[model samples]
Target: MAGGLGSKKVDITWSTEESGLLMAISVKTINFKDGKTRNYQKNLTNRRGDLLMEAVTLHRRFPYSVLAAFFFLDAGAENDGTPKRRSTFLNAHARLKLFTDRSDPAGREEQFERFYLILLEASPNSVSVRPFKVGDPDNEVSLSQMLDEILELVAERNPDFYEFDDGRLIKL
Candidate 1:
């Protein structure tokens, strides 16, 4: 994709011949713990910066495009820290709150339309995924719910083309 600053590759994107760019999602992950901190927060700031840069680059060229960001962390991040200290998960939510919820095309270019924090727990058998928004960290959502919300946001942003109904997208 051609961005305001330069060309960039997004993880996932949706577009049409009629519309240039409808939606884009950027995914980032921090899977390992910091040796000193014993937490998965060593690259939190760098990840945030990368996300902000991506948002700006994309949104500047396509203001009407819906941009979503997904940050992944190890499930252990939820409990990493001292008893009196806030967990890395909670801290990430607080740090990310300001960068999400860009509801309008004219909104800040650095803000993403949606941001999700995903914690992954992997074992020999299977992997568990828990996703949540910044403001509602306690209310984790399933993968289906996350996809539904993103599609709904896309429909909301482009009402003339798509409509979200009954947990599905209806094209107009």
Candidate 2:
């Protein structure tokens, strides 16, 4: 969509003729470790910049739009640190907290409505997905739960048009 800074593409979106861009989700992933640091922290700043820019662009164009950011890291990122240092996962949550929870359209242009961190574990046998919000790092949920939260946020933002009910969105 055309945004404050030219054009931007979002991973997922929900819109309507009456409401323009109601919701958008931007997904970013850092699946590999840095060659030198041997950690996922190397590209952390760059990813955050990208997310911030996207939020500004989208929010500026559609002030009421609900912007959600989903950042994915390898499960091993949870252990990518020395005994005295914090893991990349924890550090990411701390950094992201400042840029999330933009509850109002008049809020900061670079802040997203919601932010989620997902840790993915893939093996030859099966795959596991653990997701958590920026504020609640200790508790993890399944992918479905993360999506449900996003949907609920959307309903909350557009209460006159949508309502969250019975684990789903109901149009009123």
Candidate 3:
């Protein structure tokens, strides 16, 4: 219902009377190419911008909601007829780190909560989720860990609402 800061829509969101806006998520995917690093980075930044504005508006109403981004980066490309370029995985990660550098400082004072970038690799037969998180470069954890963090964040505001244990979401 709100529009601005390029936030035509929020990718994912949740609400409850107790927590108000609760959570808002932005999802972006990058299929890495050689020299299109800047372009891909710009695309992600644009999505991030959208998430920020939406979060701000929601937070103004709820005051306890949080914004998050889940970025999916393709580490390998199938023979999808696209031109092959030397991958800039490190550069891509750095650009995302820049995204956090801009957001995290304000996150503490605002509604932003967490960032999850899942690096995916495919071999035309199998794909896997190697999850990464912002705020800590050395942090590496499973998808369950990621969900647990979300639970913790929400728990901070809705302490009596739910519990997350061993990947199970328990409602109270």
Best by lDDT: 1
- Candidate 2 per-residue lDDT, tens place, 2-87, comes to 89888998898889999889889999999999999888998899999999999999999999999999999999999998877788
Residue 144, candidate 3: alpha-carbon lDDT: 73
lDDT of 2 at 51: 96
- Check candidate 2 and list the clashing pairs: none
Off by over 4 Å in 2: none
Q: How do all the candidates rank in terms of TM-score, highest first?
A: 1, 2, 3
Q: On residues 25-125, what C-alpha lDDT tens digit does candidate 3 reach at each position?
A: 77777765436443334355565555556556655555556566777767442222224532334444454454442223234333357776677787889
lDDT of each: 0.91, 0.90, 0.57
- Per-prediction TM-score, please? 0.94, 0.93, 0.66
Candidate 3 RMSD to the correct structure: 5.6
Off by over 4 Å in 1: none
Candidate 3 lDDT for residue 16: 68
Model 3's lDDT to the true fold?
Answer: 0.57
